[model samples]
Target chain A: MTFVLGIDGGGTSCRAALATADGAILGRAKAGAANIRSDLTGARTNIVEAARQAFLAAGEDPDLIPQTPAVLGLAGANVGTYKQQLEAILPFSRSSVETDAEIALEGAVGSGDGAMAILGTGTAYMVRKNGKSRPIGGWGFQVGDQGSGARIGRDLLEQTLLAYDGVREPSPLTAEMMGVFRNNPQDVVEFTTNAKPGDFGGFAPKVFDYAAKGDAVATWIVDKAVADVEASLGVLGLEAGDPLCLLGGLAPLYAPRLSERHRALLKTPLDDALGGAVRMAVRMFAAPVEAAR
Target chain B: MTFVLGIDGGGTSCRAALATADGAILGRAKAGAANIRSDLTGARTNIVEAARQAFLAAGEDPDLIPQTPAVLGLAGANVGTYKQQLEAILPFSRSSVETDAEIALEGAVGSGDGAMAILGTGTAYMVRKNGKSRPIGGWGFQVGDQGSGARIGRDLLEQTLLAYDGVREPSPLTAEMMGVFRNNPQDVVEFTTNAKPGDFGGFAPKVFDYAAKGDAVATWIVDKAVADVEASLGVLGLEAGDPLCLLGGLAPLYAPRLSERHRALLKTPLDDALGGAVRMAVRMFAAPVEAAR
Candidate 1:
């Protein structure tokens, strides 16, 4: 009669699911973003709220929450203190916290060896081989996240300013971006002075959209971003026969542009990170005989 | 017997000079940094303090401050509001605030038609011709500041991270920078997360130093930075026989590295920004006979 809860927490949103030990999902719920770096208190609150909503959808009494075991995959969990802090506040009788990348890898390969890359507002890659997993990139938008949407948006902004100064040739994409800032370099300066990664990431789709129309600057940015991704994928040592799944919002947009070698290796993930979290819980709470298998 | 005050306010420090109508310096004093964009209140206080100390050193009464006409060349004075706000709080009988680049150009060219480039922690160029001055760069460190020491430092940090990620070959300069960050990419990430242009600029000398010793990455960074400076200079339209002076902390460091064409046009400045401020005050307060010259 025991159930397990799974959570996928990210900078943009948090999702939760409830499932039986056998891995049949009974209910699912979602809440606002839960980025531990910027909003630890908010993330903690959203994480609890998402779990509660999932339990309610499953027709479970609120008092039964602490009796259920849970596993969570959260953005910013690589920072050990954040994971420890989030774990301390969980209401479940037993809970474990891991990085969103870890859960995505689990969900993509289903306990098998493979590689997965997430390309959302942020970018990260994980390669699972045998029983060990190695992560590359995703050091956050400031220092890493090389091929991330945020990086592309930031590059576009920089290029627009360069065009304004006549350092680089201005194209339609640069012109359109300048118009957004009222064609004032000072306004662009002020905008970047206080901008966060997600704020910059907000401009990525426009870049991609423009690139599709063959705007030179936009095309250059997209090409560089894709090259960075390909370089990282190469660094991950993705083999010809290895299964590779692209995850996150930008994945579909970028898929067609990947090189043929990568295209042949690409596979759809078996499940999402929430399902991966649930799978983790299933492994943790399964009977000894089942866990051994 | 009336005198003038000239104030030079920069991101690193503030300096003020007391000078006669004939431009003979009676006294000079310096105080802490004064950046209006980041700390307007601090800048205001430093500006006043520098002026007061200059008067005190010149054996003049502090009460004479309000009676003294002054011209202030300050960083971040390009924005009209900053000038307006600083003007409202000035103790001088008549005070005008202009960008540091403007005053530097005045000091360098001495009422003549010419151009001057300030290559300090930031980069900006000003050209004065036929009693009109136009500024070309100096769009702050975030979007512009292309040939700047801050940009070079930021680029070095980025390359160091790339080396850490194995995306780029590790060079001695990268190794030394990584050592400074405890050889941890995460530590470097933390360092850059909140770093300001000045914080980054602090590393520029080390880059130059290493480049002098032929470190590959350091040499590449300096070459690119110098090239950018050359490009900006080209855009500024430096004709032969035009007097050009390079100003700022890094100016001397970069002067010899500039192409021979630029070196031939480079001339020693008549004075510094402080002297230019005094000249401005003289222009505003000089007797008709002296003003005519």
Candidate 2:
């Protein structure tokens, strides 16, 4: 009964799962953001707590559990610099820490040879061919990340402000945004200041909701976002018939907004990133030669 | 002695001048924004006071000034509605109230048939043909004030916030904006809230400043702004030899940034909008037959 663990660590929260070599999920755990390089002590405590909770839920004694191979997909771990810090407290004998994007790509294609896009609080695109990976877009929220939810939200917010200032004409979308901010100018300031990139990205759904209700601005925003994302795909040299997988909270919401040309490239994965992580863990022991690379 | 008063009212201050039939200045006054519709009553009073001071400076009694024919070119008084409001307060027996754009256009071209563009806190374009007028742009601050100072300011502010949210990498421009905000997050709220559209527009010069100092982001912003403004010229169906005049505070700063295509259409005007107002006023009385139309 060989066991393996898979973890997906993000900016907002973390998810961990225990599975078998054959891909059966035995248990799962969830925790808050646990990036140690960003803040070591806090991340260590969060991981320990989440693991304990998962062990209790799985009806296993934490001390009696045997150490095994694990693969942790983490946001903000794109560079190799954070590996040493992660190795200090994480409990796997053979552990691999890679960007969350890599896990998403593997999960989407099962065995690479395709592309996966993550569109959460932020956005990134990853491609894998023959076990080697390449990234196209995912420069974060600053210079680019045009199609991400955060970008959409920021655009909407700016449009709303422009309307308020009478620099632009009022739009139906402005009314909806005002409603969301409770018609208080100060609340707008508060909302923007405290809003994480993903928090703004979360507003992507609201745009769709308004578009459905006949908001021209909302529709324009969604259309522009779709175009931007599609352009990213084109930049990656994605063929017309190539398979592409979408991941992240906003992916499902944005799926319908893609143009017909882009729609043809869509492929829903049978296994998600967590499943890919577990598979990677199992491969560590079963196929050591392949794992070593 | 016959007297003609020309006034130029803007957001920050107002200027009024008493000029003779020839192009000689007799006296001048400074006031503030009197576009009561925009909610700056105090500013309007300042303008009136400035005009009074101008009359005093001209060695004329303010109370006896009612006989002088005056023409005032004010900000925010576009065509249709606000023109009526301006007609009531100005002393000209047959005064025409128009956006500062018209005055700037007149100032740039004198009495010649030509086109002038105003790119201050807002933006507008006007053409004069046979002493009659046609306007091509200046749709307010919202949908299409492209290349205006306000748009540049808004873009910089948006980019700054995006950088702070960690959605994008830090750029030198972002660092400059951060320094402007004093590293205090709340400054974003204050600067944006307290800022007028023109104030943001005023920041457009700073972008030029940074670009001159070799900042890529600032240079990019300037390039994009010039492109946008130049494209707007096409809306008027201007020809290669058309007399195009550039006005407004940013016009001088952005002159070098204009594309050669737009530059080829350029014709330097002899006077500004205030001078145009004086020209219009003088023409109104000088040619009674045309004034009736």
- For DockQ, the strongest prediction is 1
**Which one is best on lDDT?**
1
Interface RMSD, per-candidate values to 1 decimal: 1.8, 10.6
State the displacement of the C-alpha of residue B221, model 1, in Å, after optimal TM-score superposition: 2.9
Separately for all candidates shown, the number of backbone clashes (residues 3 or more apart, or on different chains) is 0, 21
Per-model B-chain TM-score: 0.87, 0.78
Q: Which stretches of candidate 2 lie over 4 Å from their true place?
A: A64-66, A161-170, A175-195, A210-215, A288-293, B1-223, B227-252, B255-293
lDDT by residue for model 2 over B86-158, one digit each (tens)?
5665544456666677777778877667788787777777777666777754544433467788888877775
Residue range with the least summed lDDT across 10 consecutive positions in model 1 chain A: A284-293
Error at A34, model 1, angstroms: 5.6
Give one digit per residue, the lDDT tens place, for model 1 in B130-248: 77888877777766888798888888887888777776788999998889988877787788888888888899999999999999899999999999889888776778999999987
Pick the TM-score winner. Answer: 1
Which runs of model 1 end up more than 4 angstroms from their true locations? A11-14, A30-49, A61-67, A81-94, A283-288, A291-293, B10-14, B30-52, B61-67, B81-94, B283-288, B291-293
Candidate 1: what lDDT? 0.86
